[model samples]
Target: MSNPYAPPDPASRPPKQREHTGPDAPSPADGGPGPGKAPGRQGRAGRPERPKPTPEQLASVSRSVLHFGLFMLAAVLTMQVDLPWHLMSLAFAIGAVVVGVRALVRVFKEQIRGGIVVLLVFGLMLSGMLVVTTLGSLAVWNEQMERQECLRSAITVSAQDRCERIYQEAIEDRFGTIPGG
Candidate 1:
């Protein structure tokens, strides 16, 4: 019975070459790590061990997180509240620029992957959502205010009821009609 784990015939096996042996042993010739060379003595696949990033990369990554956070906050506020669209857009733009610049600088300095472009693309996509949300919120607020103005001039209960229904219908048309209404 053949031993599955056994080396295929010792005579057929190439003799094990010791580290740094004969003239055929690797040298820095031809601009590459030659055969039989372990780039880091114990590193896998003869690859030189990677060095850890400097404090510069760490600091820049932190700043990028902060800028991204600002963009998220602005996006939420613009969508939920009645704030001016321009103000929110300005905040979003600044956040995108700051984060992108920091990530790009780090990319060039450190030569890393998934840098500036990813963050910028995310920011722009959310910025577009913010615009749509702001328009929706503005329509809701306007409808409410118009109802209030109409009710103020209304002399009877029926007039006030009519004013409320008109505003409600207008809001429902712009958005979808509320469930259970």
Candidate 2:
């Protein structure tokens, strides 16, 4: 009448293999909770635990974070076409590249496994931002300077408005119609 698939009765098991009876006892598959079990380690076999990262390795990973932050800042700044924004974006992009280089060096020297690929991606992004911002600024340098000067000297709303119109004309002349309509 007993089910054949049911587990064998613990009472009939050998003394060493008997499942311990307690709320805190582990399952039989885990070798139970008693002298039969190896404490402080799992019975399941697989890869051994990995070693903790040294301070230098951790610092290498941290550099990636700094690189990512600088890259993000540069990306945001690059969206603006103004002269100062272009300069600032270029600066941030350069800083990101420097940080990425340091991160890569540390990763190689310390033999860390992660963060290198991400740093390379960030490096490419920063490079693109740098090139775009630099070329864009160079292309509009004179017009940007004139617009900045006019805005700086203008004291009235009408003069400030006139500065915008002049800037529009300058841009139109440079690129044959301003972008974004």
Among all candidates shown, the one with the greatest TM-score = 2
Give me the runs in candidate 1 sitting further than 4 Å from their true place.
1-31, 34-52, 83-90, 101-105, 114-120, 131-181
- True-vs-predicted CA distance for residue 111, candidate 2, Å: 8.2
lDDT of the structure predicted as candidate 2? 0.69
lDDT of 1 by residue, 1-181 (tens): 8898987896787777556646665565533355666544433554555566678876776677567667667656554433444356545645655665555566556655464557655765665566565555555776866776798799999999999889879888888888898
User: Per-residue lDDT for 137 in model 1?
Assistant: 52
Q: What C-alpha lDDT do the candidate models reach, one value each?
A: 0.64, 0.69
Candidate 1 residue 47 C-alpha distance from true site, Å:
12
Q: lDDT by residue for model 2 over 37-62, one digit each (tens)? A: 54434434533334557886687677
Pairs of residues clashing in candidate 1: none
Which is the leading candidate under lDDT?
Answer: 2
Q: Once model 1 is optimally superposed onto the true structure by TM-score, how far is the C-alpha of residue 75 displaced, in angstroms?
A: 2.8
